[model samples]
Target: MRSTFDFSPLFRSSVGFDRMLNALEAANRMAPAENWPPYDIVKSGEDDYRIVMAVAGFSEKELTITHEQNMLIVTSEKADEDEKQYLHRGIPSQAFERRFELADYVKVTAAKLVDGLLTIDLKREIPEEMKPHRIEITDETAPRQGNMHQIEAEAAA
Candidate 1:
């Protein structure tokens, strides 16, 4: 009987911020809250992302979008009715709650409900210091573009 160890790097780091690490680990281990509304995450551009949820039969008035901590939550609830009068209700028009994890600098740009889909745009604002930068090379150490020796040899030939 042999025992296996996790041996993950997360345990080897300094214990200064162990509480945050534990919270992150717990968040990652936990499954999604609910799957009541089908959604898609699409990368619109380099620093832009869009989350589209298929909320067919849900009205814009019933839906709510809110941000808590680093998570974006979208919840919806239908209006109360005295009597149910639906012969065939194929569309999913029930209460739903959806959550999305947002990056450090990501912010909600806009949200719109068109037809039956609810689209929420997110923009990641990267600081100038964090963005990738190109190093400028001086003429002295720059790599030669062509084979000058071969050109000289061809000229001699």
Candidate 2:
């Protein structure tokens, strides 16, 4: 049995969240999650993250990683070969594509394949203009002596 949710209320109240809500709804409607080519996301540092995927039987040449705006896509396709015959085939080598949504400023830094595991490193680089900074509050009621002198000099002139 499957359950459905009504987000009409959220849609009416929220603003500028259409993409996020659509992504969530699409995730809910997707087929039951597949276990093939399992992956894990880990937070390595304050602004660093790592996505490790088990890509057994896949080589570096067969895997591709791409970043388009806020979406990170990882795909792997193995070349078909009819020469190898296996009585028992348990490992999944079929073409698969996985997408990950990244937050603002999150960027892919590096990718490496080690021991049949593909590790993708990500770093969040917030621009200086976007970072939070303290704003100095000045007392407007009190006038500085320099300003008073300047005003007096201007009046005399």
RMSD of each: 10.5, 3.4
- Go through the candidates in order and give the clash count of each: 0, 0
The 10-residue segment of model 2 with minimum total lDDT is: 148-157
Residue pairs in collision within model 2 = none
- Give the range where candidate 1 is weakest over 10 consecutive residues by summed lDDT: 1-10
Q: List, residue by residue over 62-105, the lDDT tens digit for candidate 2.
A: 99999999899999879987898799989888999998898889
Best by TM-score: 2
Candidate 2 Cα outliers beyond 4 Å, as residue runs: 11-19, 138-140, 144-157
Question: Of the candidates shown, which would achieve the greatest lDDT relative to the real structure?
Answer: 2
Q: What is the alpha-carbon lDDT of model 2 when measured against the actual structure?
A: 0.91
